[model samples]
Target: MRNARFEGKVAVITGGSGGIGAAVARRLASEGAAVAIGYRGNKDAADALVDELAANGGRAIAVQADAADAEQTQALIDRVVTEFGRLDVLVSCAGIEHFDALENITPDDFDRVFAVNTRGQLFAVQHAAAHMGAGGRIVLTSSVSASKAFFGHTLYAASKAAVEAMVLNLSAELGEKGITINAIAPGGTATAMAVEYGAGYLHPELAGKTSLSDWLKTQVALKRLAEPSEVAAGYAFLASDDAAYMTGRTLQYDGGMF
Candidate 1:
């Protein structure tokens, strides 16, 4: 049973069709918040999630949008507010990753990554902040790669680093608005993106077999990779009234990986 704690809140989750975004959308909706899910592709998955939420007596809509596009991002925020009557929470989980050495990374890949991870996040927050009132919450999905200089992740790491910086800056700017902006930097978890990225180097299904808990035991103090739901718990807390005093912080949830 869910806590049923967000009885009257409204939330918007970008990249909500899959992975951590979908987990967070379900979590928030289960807790009683109305959710508008944003997706770039995967229309079927997005619609299915909306239907699932509605069938379970939760309010939800799947809006097609590319976070990398400013106009589309703004329109997504407008649609959520229009449908829900208000926007209280914003979860920016749309991102792209490319695995390549620093020298081999192309300009296009670097630009695309930043366009979604950093620029897109900024624009999403900008539009959401304009519509949100006091006590509004903004959560960006960052990664531990932001801080770790992982090999073959030069572009991806650079993009995540920018996102971390944005979260801190946005928190300071939005303080007067009574809105809190924060980020979550999670370590490796089993997701489609991870699977695709790891397939060439490892087995095709290696990502699926691996769990955050397994990694946590070795490199992480906690001995695991974080489940998407586990990361979603952090989003829930940050979005809740319980975290009212918190802002401009990045909660690293990588099983205590240093």
Candidate 2:
């Protein structure tokens, strides 16, 4: 069941090899958009996804860029436009998690989180919007932690909160250009990152053998963690014509945070 909602459109998803990012890439591609998967280091995964999408009859490419680097982020967009000749949507899903309290939080940690989750996303939009036309859409990924006060989430939440704020302000300016900016705030989701939660915290590269499947179920009204595809559905709506009139607001994909 493919839709032509995104036919002829081109989208670039940062952190495109991650669970949620990959899902968004597939979703947009399946709906008729030429997709670009941006990865910081996971070239293999990014390339594999591109191949899979192409095999499935979608146009895709893989590019390397660190989300935290402004120059690299700009280059990622430039390369995308070079490949597809147009930019219709930009989704920033590249983020990192650090579980430290105020006592343990350091400047480096704060900077890393904000650099990728907040600042990097801003620059990505800056580059994308310049190439976009009247019907452009920008969707940034914010986390439910931004509003939930989750344990060990001070830095992460603060960074994501900035994204929601960005959407609000960017809406007016982008709207003037006939483009839209919005966010998708997902609750505890079943992504590869959650596998790190088994270590008693969320974030890749942490010590863990446990997953969030059981623990996260208690955090939301829904009894299970959301799948990457479920979060992608929300992103798809924001990036499509269905939400053309919507801007400056976040589609809360949270499973009723409790």
Candidate that would win on TM-score: 2
Tens-digit per-residue lDDT, 81-193, candidate 2: 99999999999999988777689999989888899999999999999999998999999989877877656778988999999999999999999899999999987777778
lDDT per residue as tens, model 1, 1-258: 768768898999999999999999999999999999999999999999999999999999999999999999999999988898999999999999778766787888878889999899999999999998899999998888888765577778888888888888878789988999999897776678776663322323555776534534666776555678988899888888889999999999877775
The candidate 2 region of ten consecutive residues with least summed lDDT is 198-207
- Model 1 has an lDDT value of 0.86
The local distance difference test score of model 2 is 0.89
Runs in model 1 with CA error above 4 Å? 198-217
Q: Using lDDT as the measure, which candidate wins?
A: 2
Q: Which stretch of 10 consecutive residues in model 1 shows the poorest summed lDDT? A: 198-207
Q: Residue 248 of candidate 1: its Cα lDDT?
A: 90
Q: Number of clashing residue pairs in every model?
A: 7, 1
